[model samples]
Structures are given as C-alpha cells and as structure tokens.
Target: MYSICRRIIFLETVAGVPGMVAAMTRHLHSLRRMRRDYGWIHTLLEEAENERMHLLTALHLKRPGPFFRACVILGQGIFVNFFILSYLISPRFCHRFVGYLEEEAVITYTKCLNQIDRGYLPMWAKMDAPDIARTYWQLKPDAKMRDVILAIRADEAHHRLVNHTLASINPEQKNPYKPGE
Candidate 1:
C-alpha cells in the first residue's frame, strides 16, 4: 500500500505537468498569431489544476520521502519538456498521449479503491478529505478519502474521453506551423 500510494503521488505529480505545458504552449501560439485559442487554454489549464489537486490530496494521505520527492521533480521536469516538444510537433499525437495517461490514472485509482475495500490497504477510520480537495472539487461535507479517489478517477475518465475526442478532431489545423507538412 505504501508503494501504491507513492506511485499514485508520483504519477499525479508527473500527470499535472503535461496539461500545463500544452496550455502554456498553446497560449503562446495564440498570442503570437493574434487569435483566440477557442477555450482550449482554459480547459487544459483546468485539467492541470485538477491533477495538481490530486497530488495535494495524496500528499495529505502521506508526506512523500525526500527520495520520492526528488524523483517526482526529475520526472516532471523531463516529462514537461518531452510533452511540450511533442505538442509542438503534433498536437493530435500529444492529445492522444494525454488520453492514454488519463486512462492509466483512472485504472490506478480504481485499483487503489479496490485495495482499500478489500482491506489490503488500511485507511483511517474516519479520514476526512483534504480541505483543498474538498474546496477544489466542491465535494460534500461527508466526503472521505475514498470519495476523493473516486472523484479523481471520474475526472480522469472524463479527461481521457475529452482528449481522445480532441485528438480525433484535430482542431489546431488552423495554426500555420503544422509540423511535417
């Protein structure tokens, strides 16, 4: 369970980075082109924020050790650059990658929930959801850690679907810098 928790925390930290890089890159592209992003900036940034909240909630569950935190920093740094380059090269491919990432997140969280339910992972008797999580997610007063996990999984599923759909549509066709063209 400890390892699983660490994995989720690490995953969440890395997960948050791609959306931010894509959002920032898109914002720069939009600004350079003197055109609106048509709402993708907001959606991607919101996804980043949601992923960040998941990281924070996991932190509340267990403060990661120094080694773990270092790995997270390194992982995020590397992943951010890779994702930004990928997005610049091909937004459709980048979105597809994010969709895959979100699908994995949903699966991971579901596994965690199952572990908790099966008593393989011992949770607090009355663990309350993190205040940040509750506020960010607008969760009810009775929300617990399990509830938070479920909500995060649901959000990831939604992101997965959205990114998959966006990848299929390829809305950034209007951008002049179509790589490989």
Candidate 2:
C-alpha cells in the first residue's frame, strides 16, 4: 500500500501537467490566430483540475518526505516543458499520448479495486474515502476507499475517450465534447 500510494502520488502529480499545457498552448494559438477555441479550453482546464484533485485525494494516504517532493518537482518541471513543446509541435500526438496515459490510469485503478476486493490490499480494503475525494466525486458520506477508486476509474475512462476523440479531430474544428458529456 505504501508503494502504491507513492506511485500514485507521483503519477497524479505528473498526470496533471499535460492538460494545462495543452490548454494553454491552444489558448495562445487562438490568440495569435485570433480564432475561437470552441470549448476545448474549458474541457482541458477541467481535466487539469480533475487530475490535481486526484493528487490531492491520494495525498491523504501518505505524507511524502523531502526526497519525494523534490522528485515530483523535477518530474513536473520536465514533463511541463516536454508537453508544452510537444503540444506546439503536434497536438494530435500529445493528445493521443495523454489518451494512452489515461487508459493506463483506468487500468491501474481497476487493478487496485481488484486487489481491494480480493483482500490483497488490506489497508485500502478497510479505509474510508478521503474527504477531498468524497467531495470531488460527490460520493456518499459513508463512501469507502473502494468507492473513491471507482470514481477515479470512471474519471480516467472519460479522459481516455475524450483525448482519443480530440486526437482524431482537426485542431480548428469545434470540440465535440460538450461541458459534461
């Protein structure tokens, strides 16, 4: 469980970078071209915030030391620069990469759920959802960590589909996803 928490903490911290980078890149492009964004920025911003929320939820389970924090800082800095350059060079590739990333996130959370159900992760099996998770996911007051995992898996699935769709579309085309679809 400690290992899993550490992995998730780092993963979530890094996962939160791409969306903000893509959104900002597109925003600047829109301004430079004097064109409308067609709702992509909103969704991208929401994705970034959702990933941040996931990081916050996982943080409730573990308190990282100085080394871990430094690693996250370095990882985030590297990822942010890489993603920004990649988004500028090829938005489609960046979006597809993020789609794959979210697919792995879904898979990871699904595996975690399986472990909890099978009693392989005893601590998580008995744990309650963090308050941040409960609020972010609108889970019931009695929600457990299992419930939190379920919500996270769902969110990841949504992001996976959204990014794949975005990758397939023309950059100037209007985003197909509405606010909450």
Candidate RMSDs in Å, in order, are 5.3, 0.8
> Which candidate number has the best lDDT?
2
> Please, what are the lDDT tens digits per residue for candidate 2 over residues 96-178?
99999999999899989999999999888789999998888899999999999899889999999999999999988999988
Top-scoring candidate (TM-score): 2
Runs of candidate 2 with Cα error greater than 4 angstroms are none
Instruction: State residue 13's C-alpha deviation in candidate 2, in Å.
Output: 0.3
Q: What is the lDDT of residue 44 in candidate 1?
A: 78
What pairs collide in candidate 2?
none
* TM values, all candidates: 0.89, 0.97
Task: Compose the digit string of candidate 1's lDDT tens values, residues 1-181.
Answer: 6787788888888888877988899899989999887767777787788888888888887888889878878887888888888889998898898999899888898888887788776663257888988887789988888888888899899889877876887565433222211
Count of clashes in candidate 1: 0
Error of 1 at 23 (Å): 0.7
